[model samples]
Target: MTTDGFTTCLWFDGQAEEAAHYYVSVFKNSSVGRVSHYTEGAMQPAGTVLTVEFTANGHKFVALNGGPQFKFTEAISFQVFCDNQEEIDYYWTKLTEGGGEPGPCGWLKDRFGVSWQIIPERLDEMISDPDTAKSSRAMQAMLKMHKLDIAALEKAYAGE
Candidate 1:
């Protein structure tokens, strides 16, 4: 509760603690914060974890151990913007471990069904280039990618 801002709350089926641990381990400058348990709830038993506050690269989040009444979709996601391919590869590999699935344009769904966008900062530089032709080529290249190859995007922007 040190930092003051909006915290994103994630719903999970009794895996909030585990997810918090996993996420803090993946992102830099992250850690788990306060943990609260329920006293009497229809979903989970008393004494079970109700909410866990955590952080990822300075962004705050709260995970709730809600029941299976809800499920995660692609409507919302946490984006990890990397400056280079190495950082991008590190996040991509770690988040996709276990039962994760890869999606096009640097998108991936983790084991917990949470969507993540592992994008390189250069992607924007290329896609937003002043030259319309170069930007269009970069967009086309990005549309065909999974993990997002920064080198390929640069190549497309250069029209080579």
Candidate 2:
């Protein structure tokens, strides 16, 4: 991977343009990129968009209105490593707009049906503690919640 970074392409049935714009509006440092369309009599009509490229949070993504043969699954997800609770809460709230649902370990599905994991960077230390008892407590604490609470994780790690 170059310093330029990598981008992920999301396939939408026919809402590529709309979805691209929506995502660009959400994250900072985001903008819609090139838009290409199929020529007349091509696979799709001339005015019909063939691809829409967009960037969000500095990550690039292409939305292809390639029909409905594929859909987003839980197998793939975006991970948001939050350094503080405010950031976590902000992302969680914004992401859950519409029909998004919160899941364990800070996992959530956005209104657009995109899965995301909003977690604190400190979680690695808490879960990877050399002490098995502390690790167990942290795991238990983590399993019971949807949006991860950094404070609670820290408390558990400290045996508080």
Candidate 3:
């Protein structure tokens, strides 16, 4: 067996190549890698795309054209930690474009139905603070917003 580290595999219904390219375009340190095609006696057409290996934000992934038997659900989501509101907004906008739906509390489903959580890096610190009042306020602020706002969360944490 290969001793490779964990690589996430995303199941797609004949959209493996498209998803791989889209993910690579959205991320900074990303690139599309090797692509595998179906062979004779395979479940799909012999020349059809089987899997597309890619690296998005330095994370390895494989987009598989595994048919419509499987679909992505909110049960599994990718969390993008941002240093500031600009980063959060950028990711939120890009991920929510082209038929993507925005959910509550920084959660959104991309065009391909993949869920993502764009959150501020400081959110954990604010929510986990020893002061219950501050943490509670921060949590309240977060609950009301779709895309996370760092400034608002800070203000709430400070009781301002």
> Of the candidates shown, which would achieve the greatest lDDT relative to the real structure?
3
- Best candidate, TM-score: 3
Q: Give the per-residue lDDT digits (tens) of candidate 2, residues 45-158.
A: 788888998888888888898887888878999998899999999899988987788877789988767899999988888888899999989989999889988899889878
Q: Is candidate 2 or candidate 3 better by TM-score?
A: 3
Cα lDDT, all candidates: 0.92, 0.86, 0.94
Off by over 4 Å in 2: 1-5
TM-score for each prediction?
Answer: 0.95, 0.89, 0.97
Give me the displacement of residue 43 in model 2, in angstroms: 4.3
The order by descending TM-score is: 3, 1, 2
Name the candidate, 1 or 2, with the larger lDDT value: 1
Clashing pairs in 1: none
- Record all residue pairs in model 3 with backbone atoms less than 3 Å apart, i.e. clashing: none
Candidate 3 lDDT for residue 38: 100
lDDT digits (tens) for residues 1-160 of candidate 3 = 1228989999999999999999999999999999999999999989999999999998999999999999999999999999988999999999999989999999999999999999999899999999999999999999999988888999999999
Backbone clash total, candidate 3:
0
Candidate 1 residue lDDT tens string, 100-124: 9999899999999999999998788
